[model samples]
Target chain A: MAFTLDEAQRIVSIALNHGRDAGWNPLSAVVLDAGGHPIAFARSDGASPGRYAIAEAKAYGAIMLGMGGRAQMARAEAQAYFMGTVNGVFGGKVLPVPGGVLVRDLDGAVIGAVGVTGDSSDNDAEAACAGITAVGYTPEP
Target chain B: MAFTLDEAQRIVSIALNHGRDAGWNPLSAVVLDAGGHPIAFARSDGASPGRYAIAEAKAYGAIMLGMGGRAQMARAEAQAYFMGTVNGVFGGKVLPVPGGVLVRDLDGAVIGAVGVTGDSSDNDAEAACAGITAVGYTPEP
Candidate 1:
């Protein structure tokens, strides 16, 4: 089944709250279906205005690559030219950052992705992982 | 208060359902906050792949111009040069069409905008108005 709107909102809520509870900066989170289209999004109070787009782009990247942002970063680092070409094809939607995480269903099929931004990349990734777990999905990364 | 994610999704849900109930084509809807940043989005099943970006651009046009897409289209038709300049300024984010409607709070302050795409422009505008009304917000045009 596709990632439902309720699930997407739950993911965003969990991620943003996790970042707040951890004393990180205000965070923005986006959930995208497997097709790389946004399902839901939220920007926590006080988050920078730009965080919304960044988070959505990160999630889009994860779904487009069928992998987490951390893994994508590693791959891009090893194949810079190929990655640049891929980025151009996506109109720069792919962000090789730590905050984007792939979400898989119980059968281990990638269903969607969660992207968090606002704090350090590591903290953003941590929040995304927390959200994925809260939603009973595997977080790839 | 900013446009919350919940409200954005609610708007999308209502708009999509309205389109479906009317037996229109599958649609994509996007909600942008007052600052013209996307807060949430959804693409209905069977919608053309291009609807998402078009919906976003329509909403961006509505918010940036502080008017509904229909009004913007009217103005654009009257002043093609000025409309071209505006489009250049926004890097083509502005789409002068009937599908984008401004959202306002009870106090009549602009809070966000919603755009619907996939059907005829008139049908899209009707769907957007239904969505805004469903979310207890004013739908301008």
Candidate 2:
């Protein structure tokens, strides 16, 4: 199934609300289609100006690598030199941060990804996972 | 009203479809929020890799100047020195090209902007205008 715009907005709202309800700092979230293109994004009132770009880049990296940001981080750690070169090639679009999570449909296909920012890396990841779960999809974290 | 993600995606789809129905070249379209951050984007098959960046830059220029790209071009023509300075300040993010249009709510407040590329400049602007009108919004061109 296509990763519809409705689903992308739902994911962003759910992720941001989860962070807000937990009394976390204001967050920015981005949802990207499988092609590494943004589908939806939102930045809370107090989020830093740069959070929007960071969130989109994180989600782009996840969809590009077909894995969660944490998993991409692990790979980056194992191949630091290679990842650095890859990052340069992508003009720094690949951010191997912990906040990006892959969204998988019921058929086990990667449909898109969600990225959250404005909290600790682990907390960001949790918020993204929570959003995916809320939308009845699997979060490949 | 906020330019919702659903509206952004709808605009992109409608713009692309308009081009397709007219037998135009493959296109890339982008939707940006009021703050100039991308909300949605799509590049059709066979569209050049550069179209994405060009489309986004066009949209950004429109939103930044609070007018359509063609209008921005008029300003750029009338004040070449000033526009040159502005371009340098924005690090070339501002591109005064035809294909970018401002999206406005029913109340006539600027909500966001849409940019399309991969055809003649006037045709690109026409497609964007069509998309905004299809969604019952105003396209300032």
State the DockQ, from 0 to 1, for candidate 1: 0.39
Docking quality (DockQ) for each candidate: 0.39, 0.17
Runs of candidate 1 with Cα error greater than 4 angstroms are A1-6, A20-23, A64-66, A73-90, A104-110, A134-136, B20-24, B76-89, B104-109, B134-136
User: Clashes in candidate 1: how many?
Assistant: 0
Q: Indicate the worst ten consecutive residues by lDDT in candidate 1 chain A.
A: A39-48
Q: Between which residue pairs do clashes occur in model 2?
A: none
Q: Which lDDT value does model 1 have at B28? A: 81
Q: Which stretches of candidate 2 lie over 4 Å from their true place?
A: B1-35, B38-55, B63-67, B73-141
- Model 2 over residues B40-97: C-alpha lDDT tens digits? 6676766664676788888988888888988888988899887778767777777787
Share of the reference A-B contacts seen in candidate 1: 0.43
Interface RMSD of predicted model 2: 5.1
lDDT value, residue A140 of candidate 1: 88
- Per-residue lDDT of candidate 1, residues B12-40 (tens digit): 88998999998999888888889888776
